[model samples]
Target: MKDLLIKNGDLVFTGTDFRLVKGSEQLRQNVESILKTSEGEYVLDEDLGLNRENILGKGFDEELARTDIVEAIGQEQRIEEVSQIDFEKNGRELKINLKMIEMDEEELELEVDLDA
Candidate 1:
């Protein structure tokens, strides 16, 4: 798959055109988008993203958050399985680091940050 690259929630422009990404980069970006978006935010796919209430609130359950992460990513067809997943929180910021193994054995290392 190919897509216009987005950085910091904005489309990337290079001179008179936009930056593009494909293959692993595209996959990485897609996953990042999934992780960053709050569930129910996208109208067409109301269940497409992570549930922020689970991972970002006062009574946060790590396991439930993990389940939310897995379930959301499962909707993505390109991923075979997630090998490793970790979460670190500092104050109101959450950092998610994961290693995904694709169907063709291509390994992807993705890190996503969200304000908790």
Candidate 2:
């Protein structure tokens, strides 16, 4: 799969010049999107995102939060299985280490961040 490269929510190239993201880079982008998007935010796919309602402010349980995120990733067809997950929380910021297998049997390690 290939997609236009996006950085900071904007296309990385101007008119007539396009940067494409392919292979592992594209997969990484998909993973990032899954983590960054809150459930119900995208009108087309209301059930296709993560539920981050309990990740911010008070009543934050690391285990529950990680479970939610893991389940969200599991819902994606491209991911075959999640082998490992490591979460590091600092205030409203979170760092996640993920090891997963793709549908094609490729194993990948990804790092994702969330800021509440």
Candidate 3:
């Protein structure tokens, strides 16, 4: 029952090859409209709604950015696979496995495997 409201949020596509895309930061700010748009825009569809009883799993990226402290300390952390997010694109369902390393509340830095 946690409600997350992202204001002026930037969405990224975490693909197998670590391919990133500017996902609809240019689209309307109204979150409802954005969610209803096609997956080509990289927005999660209706089935992915926060209250839809279909949110597979969730995690927090507490310290979203790589800071000097983190580098200095070299804290050992692993990118755990949270869940596979599937969305419709061109009449086909595409799956993207989400992996996250919890940071703080600054920004959400999703872990992308460069060596896919």
Candidate 4:
């Protein structure tokens, strides 16, 4: 693994309520800080919600949803809707559709469609 070299395509998260920017050192700093306080694996979606996992295959779950209120309730509906957002590395395909959900929440769904 140490001998492996790779390239990471830029990941940009944009939405009506929140944006997890890419190529910003400031954002990287913030992310690093948050990761320090976090346990397990996590992924940032278009709505900037952090998905965390205790084990490897726990799957993505909304840990925090974007909201105007820091201490708000029932406002998870404020995020932009996401119908289908998928990414497959071995299959080399990416598809996204934002019109699936009724709510305005953003969904950054990423998946790997690998073949055995």
RMSD in angstroms, all models? Answer: 1.0, 1.7, 17.7, 13.4
Q: Per-residue CA lDDT of candidate 1, range 1-116, in tens?
A: 79999999999999989999999999999999998888999999998888887888777777888888888788778999988889898888889999998878999999999898
Q: So what's the TM-score on candidate 3?
A: 0.17
lDDT measured at residue 37 in model 1 versus the true structure, 0 to 100: 84
- Model 2 Cα lDDT, one tens digit per residue, 67-91: 8888889766788888888878888
lDDT of each: 0.88, 0.83, 0.26, 0.27
Q: How many clashes does each candidate structure show, in the order listed?
A: 0, 0, 6, 8
Give the candidate order by descending lDDT: 1, 2, 4, 3
Query: Sorted on TM-score, highest at the top, how do the candidates line up?
Result: 1, 2, 4, 3
Best by lDDT: 1
TM-score of each predicted structure versus truth: 0.95, 0.87, 0.17, 0.20
Candidate 3 per-residue lDDT, tens place, 16-93, comes to 333332332211123232232322444544333122112122321223212211321122122122222223222222
The best candidate in terms of TM-score: 1
Model 1 poorest ten-residue lDDT run: 53-62
Residue 3 of model 4 has an lDDT of: 14
lDDT of model 4, residue 100: 23
In candidate 4, how many clashes are counted?
Answer: 8
In model 4, the worst 10-residue window by lDDT is 65-74
